[model samples]
Target: MTRGHFDDGALLAARLLLAGLFLGGAVQKAVDPAPAMALLAMRGMPEFLVWPALAFNALAGTALVLGVWTRPVALALAGYAAFTSIFHFQPADPWQMTIFVKNWAIAGGLLALAVAGAGRLAWRGGR
Candidate 1:
């Protein structure tokens, strides 16, 4: 659709799905921080960085879900997804392939949100 004719309902649906997915992942990490930390450690990230990463994931996901500061959150999540793709998914194992595709797809959607704003169907602002 043209920018002016963008479907707000579709955008809202996409945003909600993305936001829920992000929030769920963040909650999973928060609920089991040790495993998340272990995964990060296995990826060679510093141990001290795990908590902050977890917090960012949670906060950014929440913001996206709530349609609060949507552009910034989408941009942050797009960066996070890019990092995940480059760092966590480069090995190209079967399992990693799925994650790589998923991350990139999410990144694409987030980038769209960043460009399009949250749309009129969002809970705040534009609506």
Candidate 2:
């Protein structure tokens, strides 16, 4: 079809994929929050804030997927991802380092979404 239609489709796909990553992680964490909490505690996060973090993930993911106030939602998620990457610093370990890099990459993608927006296919009427 037209270039605009293609771009919108790509944007929609990217938004869905990025949102799915957060949603899946949130679901997994909700299923087993204790381990995540322990990890967060090790990373110096307060025990009281664990549930709030999980809720943030779920709500942010939902908001992104639904394209509701997408730029702001993506900005928040980008900040959260950046904070989480720093919180879990472990540069000496290969797996941890890879994950650290991945987190930053995800943050970058979220920032891009914040700039490009949800496009025309979004529920909130993007264009």
Predicted structure with the largest lDDT when compared to the true one: 2
lDDT of candidate 1 over 3-122, digit per residue (tens): 343587777777788878777777877777686676678887877776787678778877766678888889989988888775456564877778888898889999999988877656
Runs in model 2 with CA error above 4 Å?
A: 1-3, 125-127
36-120 per-residue lDDT for model 2 (tens digits): 7877888777765767887888898888787888899999999988988865578678887887888899999999989988888
> How many collisions per candidate?
0, 0
Let me know the TM-score candidate 2 reaches against the reference structure: 0.90
Clashing pairs in 2: none
Model 1: CA > 4 A from native: 1-6, 90-92, 125-127
Query: How much does candidate 1 score in TM-score?
Result: 0.82
Q: After best superposition, candidate 1 residue 32: deviation in angstroms?
A: 1.4
TM-score of each: 0.82, 0.90
